[model samples]
Target: MTMKTSFAFALAGLALVVLALAPLVLPDYWTGVLLGMTGYVTLATAWALFSGPTRYVSLATVAFFGVGAYTVAVLNEVMPYPLVLLCAAGIGMTMALLVGLSTLRLAGVYFVIFTFGLAELVRQTVSWWEVNVTYTMGRYVFLPFEGRHIYWQLLVLAAVTLLISWAIGRSRIGLALKALGDDETVAAHAGVDVTRIKLLLFVISATIITLVGAIQAPRWTYIEPSIVFNPTVSFMTLIMALLGGAMRLWGPLVGAVPLFLLFEWLSVSFPDHFSIILGLLFILIVFVMPNGVLAKFDDLRKGNRA
Candidate 1:
């Protein structure tokens, strides 16, 4: 194998070992934090896989995530957990394919607005269905699983997401994605098959995001449209990807750790002012590291080499 591939395999093994041992030794609170952060990391990583290379700026994380959550809520008791995840993936991929075909042609602000609007549409539709058809506010999903098991499950999912992302980053498809992002018309003229690649990446991203949502569903005792469809998840996913360095493989994981910690701190210590504090921090990150902190570091390393 190539040195790069070998290094990647070594890192994956190391991460697996760490994740496996973490829940056993850490306190319950820390294990829970690991679980939550891993979920967000998976979301950010999945988003970066598509949005970073293609610059699509999707706001549909909440929509796909909520779909998976609601799927679990509706099917948790009817099927095994593994089967429920497969169902969630299928539904998410179907939604992504339809959405991608419709909106992938649009560019810039129109695309962003469409995605954001789609999230709102899904949220509203779920709310309406809950009130009218289901006649309920939320559903209770009883997971007969332990906290450690959940943590390990999330860790495995995150690992798989990262591996796929890394493979894409190194392959020819990644080159095509970058070219398409730079200039879709030119890339298409050069026979890059822009439409097919973007749609494939979108479906892959949606599948991973939905799977994370499905796996995390039972973490909450009650699942509601309002909770699962919250815009905060969408916003954070984008922010984490940008903050960590969207172009790099490790950016989302690096960004998710500190940001998640800060979010938890502000939410607990200054709940009323959490938004204000987080907003200010986000502004600082954007202003200081527009291409992401990882990109800045990469630039510095390149300069040093020169």
Candidate 2:
């Protein structure tokens, strides 16, 4: 293998080794932080599959995530875990289908606005549904509290997410997606079905994300509207992608962990001042490392070698 390829494998190996030991070595609080960060990995990796390669910015991650969470909650309430997973995946794909049909016709900011609106609608719907469910089922509306199993479940989610990312990064579709992302007109002239590619990616990414949400609900042992539909999840995913340099194999991992840890530490250390500090940090990171921290480091290293 080439040096770059060998380096990538070694890095991946080192990450896995650390991750395997994390459960046994880290404190429960740190493990929970890691688990929380894994949630962003699920969303970021899913978002990247289309956005990173196809240049489709989807802010509807919260919407898709909410749909998946609700699907899992509803199905698990009535059916079984495995069936709930399938149902959630279907719901996610169905939402993606509807979104692609309606908005892929538009370009640029219009497309983003439409998806954002769709996500907002999902948030409102979840909020309304939570109240309705509470009224309908009274005390039994939510799941009972569970323990550390949630982290284990989230580990599975991280694995599944990484697998999808790897597969898409190696596929012919990945190349086509990159072409479309770079220039749709050129992609179309080259005989690529730009619309079909976008639609297919939307569905696939949504389905994968839905599976994560499905597993997440039961792990949390509860579901609420705000938690399920929060745009914080979407924001964190975006930040993860940007931090990792969007298109790179392990950007999300590098970006998500540090920022997530920072968030937790800031929140604990400064409490009231944490939000403003984090806000400043976000701006600083983006301004200083527009291509992402990894990209900047890569350039610097190459420059030194030169």
Candidate 3:
């Protein structure tokens, strides 16, 4: 490996070590917060894996995440936790494959709208099933495990996501995706196999996202369609990726950690205005630093030198 790749792997290893040890040292509240943050960070990174390189602004995260959560919620009673988790991942991959094949060809605003609408479609379908067939508002899940167990699981998953993203960013496939993002027609003309790569990345990304939802579902004890399929979840994932620099492997982590903390603070201190504050911040970022906070900093340094 080259120096940069080696350094990135080292950094990822160090981060994993720290995350693994964090719950041991943290208080209950802090551990819970970290668990949530790690989950979002993982989701954001998974999102960046496909969307960043492809420049596809997908809002389908909620669909996959909700599918994972619901799959576990429904199957946990009949199967072991590990089995449920695996099944959830499979279901998520299937959903991604179907959705990506059908909608990946749509470009620009149409693609975004289709994804957003797909999430709502799934949410409504689940809601209808719950009310008409199950006659329940939500499913009850038994979580006999401690908080730290979930925390460790999430930490490991997040670490793996970081590693995978870093590897992809440096691989030949990464080049194709980057090229695809620049111009899909050119990438295809250059023999990049655009369709296959897009679908594969979509499935891979969905699998990781579902794994997170399945692993974390037990911590919630109860999950409703509306709760799991909330648009805010997808929105936050997108925001984190954008704010940190979606093209960079570390972007999701950089975005998720601080933004999650800020969200927690706002929810606690000014619950009524939390959304407003977050929305304004998002708008400000879009207008002033569309390339991301880190990019903006680099630009400022370059200007200073000039």
Candidate 4:
């Protein structure tokens, strides 16, 4: 590797080491906060993996995330934890494949609206099944995982996601995705398999999101369609990714940390108005920093150099 590449790897390794050791030293509350932060970091980064270069703006994140959580809730009692996770991944992959095949052809706002609707459809379907067939509204997850365990798992997953995103960003597929985002017609004319590429990335991103939900299920202890399939998850993932400038590999992480903390504070301090504040923040970010905070920073740097 070149010097710059080597330095980046070294820095990433060091950061991972530090994060890995954090739960061991931190208090319970802080560890929980870190766990929440790590979860969003993974979600936002994975969301960006497909939406960033492709500009798909998916709101189906909660659909797969809820699937994973429910998968674990349904099977955790009978299967080993690792096997439950594997099953969740399989189910998530299948769902993503089906959704991607059906919807990848639709672009722009249609795709966005469909994805948002997908999460609601899944949530409502699950709700109906529970009420009509299962005679229950929720399932309990009784895994032996503590907050620290979940934190470590999320940290590892976040690191893996970052590595995968970085790898993809350096690959030929990345170039095709950027081109596809710029103009789908031109990209297809240039011989890029637009449909296949979009489907592949969407599946990968959705699967990771599923795994995140599965791993986080134990933290909730009790899972229901409404709780696990919250639409806020989708909106927050999008906002965080966009705020960080999803086009860059590390942009989601940059946006997730501070926003997650701010969100936590808002929920605690202004529980009644948290949703209103979140909506306002979303509007502000879209209007003032449409390209994201990182993009704005880049513009400033370029201007200074000029």
| Per-residue lDDT of 186 in model 1 | 93
CA RMSD of each candidate after superposition: 1.9, 3.3, 1.7, 1.4
After aligning candidate 2 to the native by TM-score, how far in Å is the CA of 230 from where it should be? 1.4
Q: Give stretches of model 1 more than 4 Å off.
A: 304-306
1 or 2, which is superior by TM-score? Answer: 1
The local lDDT score (0 to 100) that residue 283 gets in candidate 2 is 82
The TM-score values for the models, in the order shown, are 0.95, 0.85, 0.95, 0.97
lDDT per residue (tens digit) for residues 209-260 in model 4: 9999999999999898989998899989999999999999999999999999
lDDT of 3: 0.87
lDDT of 3 at 30: 89
TM-score of 2: 0.85
Report the number of the highest-TM-score candidate.
4
Worst window of 10 by summed lDDT in candidate 4: 297-306
Lowest lDDT sum, 10 consecutive residues, model 3, at 297-306
Alpha-carbon runs more than 4 Å astray in model 2: 1-18, 129-148, 304-306
TM-score for predicted model 3 compared with the true structure: 0.95
lDDT of 1 by residue, 144-207 (tens): 9777888888899899999899889779998898888788899999999888998999999999
Q: Give the TM-score comparing model 4 with the true structure, all chains together.
A: 0.97
Model 1, CA-based lDDT:
0.88
lDDT of 3 by residue, 184-285 (tens): 999999999998999999899999998888888888798998888888889889999999988888887898989999888888999898788978988987
Q: Which residue pairs clash in candidate 1?
A: none
Each candidate's number of clashing pairs is 0, 1, 0, 0
